[model samples]
Target chain A: MFSEWELKRYKRQMMLFGDDGQERLKKAHIFIAGAGGLGSPISIYLAVAGVGTITIVDMDVVDQTNLNRQILHFDRDVGKKKTASAEEKLQALNPDITVNAIDVKIDESNAVKLVGKADGIVDAMDNYPTRYLLNDVAIAKEIPLFHGGIRGFYGQATTIIPGITPCLKCIFPKAPPKEVFPVVGVTPGIIGTIQANEVIKYLTGCGELLTNRLFIWDGMQAHAEELCVERNPACEACRGITTKTPARTKK
Target chain B: MTVKIRFFARFRELLGTDIVTEVVPGTMFTSLITTTARKNPAGYAAIFDEKGAFHEFVILMKNGKRIELTDAAKTPVVDGDEIAVFPPVAGG
Candidate 1:
């Protein structure tokens, strides 16, 4: 049941997916794990795409350094909490969709609760520990995890469908050493948009998901390729855990 | 025999990629990467530790199948093999 305004708002995209697909977007809820570089574009795109609800969690204040890539925040938002900045911008972007910007650290203690009732989880996080936590939750809930990471001119993204695909732990058994990594704004811009694209594709059932494959983007070389990845039967994070896909059409 | 080695991410920046070189029929996987990586000292250092062994975190694949770091030395490279070596990037 779309309002006249809602139908008008999604006219262009609705052409691709039709009214039923648009209805799915209007009924879906997505949880984004960061409000920084990657999160900025992901949430912004999803909001405008009319994902019915978006829960974005971040605990840091917008730093001046973040403005280069964290597009959700502006120079004036430097000292403000990222959640506050993100909420204001997202709500303004699509008043039709609901946005819940939470200010909290997504730790093991609260990761599950923070992500409650979402259709999918987007890993816009900068670090692997939290990404792993989100992976665990995705496996537990049988939700898809849209994973992306960026550094300098390199980024990698993969969609994990819990029991059906290789979990993040299966792909990268170890996390790289942390650094004050160098990055240009376009790096996350490229990667985050791919993640958002994956989300839209997943929700609309329009195309093949990035499952069982790692999409590697090398902006320096302008090369995009995918490497075949498989589930590790002995994966520490999801070994022996079988999951049933959530009934996406149950509504 | 000839084999092609592909390095990715930081390793690619240091060693360059899609390296095709001739090797003896019985060359092992570890030696093939070592010989190709040794052309540049920094590249060698990035792929291997001070002990001349692959870094623990480096991922190695042979013809798209994962080759364990411990087994690299025992794994022999076949003719026309494609080996991929990469280091995962850990930033946002």
Candidate 2:
């Protein structure tokens, strides 16, 4: 039963997209990796937007450090699993939707199957190995992937539409040695919001996407730009690689 | 010849923008940046650190091929090339 108040509350967005947009929202399922900095905003935005279903995958436990930007949890929620805390917050925010909080880390073994289950995925995980796995599986399976990353005063995003756009591997074959680069949590919030925007735009079949174009934002100088990138015909993850789609993981 | 420019992750932040262009002769990839940076200080500062070498995490590419910063000065740019700069990417 759609309520008048709910309709009024969502009128602006509904007006922009119409009943068809609402239907797509009702049909969409989003898989978000990580419940850390980026995941917090991604979760909140998707849930509030009335996405029909969301599966949040993360294994970390909340700590004091995350409170600065992990808006899904609070001081009292510390020591709770991140996926659980985020799930609780998201469900509380939108009782109209389903939030599946999976408390687990994504790995090669489970990457393909887990990703295949969703309509699209938001790359919110904060490391390289998992990023590669996400890129590889997403490409092999021909799924849309929204990628966002933030550190210090900078952040970037790109939309990978499987074979249509470049995968993360074509751009970066290997990850640099991980480091605790200086970061302010809100940076992730900014980028994560854009990631959510891309997800929404992709789901609703809205305007032209960031496909093949990278959106970069810098907080220091308050400047942003979009650069064009093309697919590499020989990309190991896309064209010339012999790889198996990792089967869906044990539920 | 013309070369396309790209920025990713942190490099995009420090530079404050994404794409740039240059219509220079086949100069070294590094020189093309210096030429482009002449008009955009943020782009210059974004790529070359205090020592003028790309920061350790920075990755440079020529027409989609990865190029070591040490050789950026010698990597000749050809027509229709795309040069990319990215901070260490961290995401899944």
Candidate 3:
């Protein structure tokens, strides 16, 4: 049910995915956990790609210091809420899709509700506690979680397909000590793009996702590599949880 | 036994990775990494605590499998094993 405008808006990309793929993107709803740094590129790309609904949550107002890496906000948006800024820009980018920008801080209590019935959750958060929360919700819902994080010139991304791939806790059991992490825009630009690319691929059922591997990008040396990762049998987060479909026995 | 050690993110920046080093056949995972990481004091400090144990957040993997910190001391490295050590970046 694409509008005449949508077919035209997504003309070039539709060539890559065909009309069916375009329809998948038009029907998918994605929940992004932040509107800063990584969230900026992730949401922008998803919005333009015509993901039917986007729910982005952020509690911080744009500050001058954020202009460096948080591309969603500009100098003019310095004093405005990040949600307001994000909503305005995303809607302007694609008038066809719906954008819901929530201004509440994501904690254990409201995280599940805020996420609602989205097809997938994108972790653009800056802290592990909240990321853990999102991970729980993703596992509970059996939805994929596209995870990305950046620091200085380095970034990492992994796609967690709930029951199929290793959960975030299985990969990194402990959170690195929190700090005012150093970052440059391109770091998130690279990682966030990878995340958005993951979302598009997931929604369209395209190429193999980044399952069972951790994609590491080191901008300093301009190198990218993936370390093969396995699920821990005793993983506290996903232990004993198998995919819904039972394996068929060989004849 | 020859083993390859790969460090990621800040640890990689400080230590430089893909280190192929020969260790005694019975070398434990912790000691092997400790010996290599010691080449750079800051890198060693980043991965180890004051008591020389792996920092709580440092993740260790051997042949694509997780090696819990509690078991790192007991886990032994075999020939041709690829070990990865990294700290997860907590930024957006």
Candidate 4:
């Protein structure tokens, strides 16, 4: 329970979401798969908001290149494990919250167990295999997931309400065949913050999350675009799930 | 027969604007990528780099459905098919 002062600190949001939102935030448990660029903002924001629990899974060690974007790690924290360093600082950010730091690459073997333990999963991974891995696991487990991606000056964000909103596999039946790509730091900041916002909105039941719509940012010209995405019956992730029949997208 | 090709996210940047309507069949999704870019290099330079391959971030969809890379050409297209072109998305 947040103290009176603590409650006052979050007054603006509390006034918006009311006590119900606060309770939901305290009841939610989220798994953040990548603690690099995207993971940094999501993990920190969720923690500060007092999400009941946050489990971060990552295996990469910090490189100097991370400094520009990974605000969670400092120059002195360089060479340290990203999950560990992030956990230490995130806990310090909100000691009242719980933070689980798993220092390992999330793969087929562990994705199931991790995602199954959460109410929602946030895709913060770096590559296609892992992103696909997360998509597969989330859809299989029927968990809501918020997805975001940022590269160079471009970024996109969407939420998959499992069986309801279209899964990544529906939008992208297969990986893009490209492993390494270019990215800018702030782009992740922009996209990750939106993801974090989705979590809060969903938890508080305040407003509509970005479902079935791909929100995009184009940095070259610095403009925004939104395109409708649809749930595909042929999607291996959602096909024959037999749960949320006649899935609908919120305009 | 005109197939509408739409671009989203990074793909739009590489190829300015979000859409293009061409009087080409759907089966030519792969063929048109290279040919169209060659015809309008400035409209698609970042889409395919020096190697003359997709720049890694781009994805192609036909009528709202993804065009599997393996069966990209055989993905089938019809008149008035709306093809979606996207770049790999990464936030979370």
- Clashes within 3 Å, all models in order: 0, 1, 0, 6
Candidate 1 global lDDT: 0.90
Off by over 4 Å in 2: A1-6, A240-251, B1-27, B30-57, B61-74, B77-84
lDDT for each residue of candidate 2 in A1-251, tens digit (9 for 90 to 100): 35676577567899889877777876788889889888999989999998889999998999998887788889999999987798889988988889999987799888777765688889997887888888877776666788987778777889887766778876555566676666787788888999999888887877778888778777886878766666767777888533343111110
lDDT of 4 by residue, B6-82 (tens): 66665565564544555545456666666655646655665666766665556666665556654665556678777
Query: Per-residue lDDT of A61-105 in model 4, one digit per residue for the tens?
Result: 999988888888999999999888998999899877788999877
What's model 4's lDDT at A65? 81
TM-score of model 3 (first chain only): 0.97
Q: Which structure is stronger by lDDT: 1 or 4?
A: 1
Better of 2 and 4 by DockQ: 4
Mark the regions of model 1 whose C-alpha exceeds 4 Å error after superposition. A244-251
Supply candidate 1's per-residue lDDT for B91.
75
Every model's DockQ: 0.75, 0.31, 0.84, 0.38
Candidate numbers, best DockQ first, in rank order: 3, 1, 4, 2
Report, to 2 decimal places, the DockQ of model 3: 0.84
lDDT of 2 at A240: 51
Candidate 4 CAPRI category: acceptable
Could you tell which candidate, 1 or 3, scores higher by DockQ?
3
- Fnat, model 2, is 0.36
What C-alpha root-mean-square deviation, in Å, does candidate 3 show against the real structure? 3.0
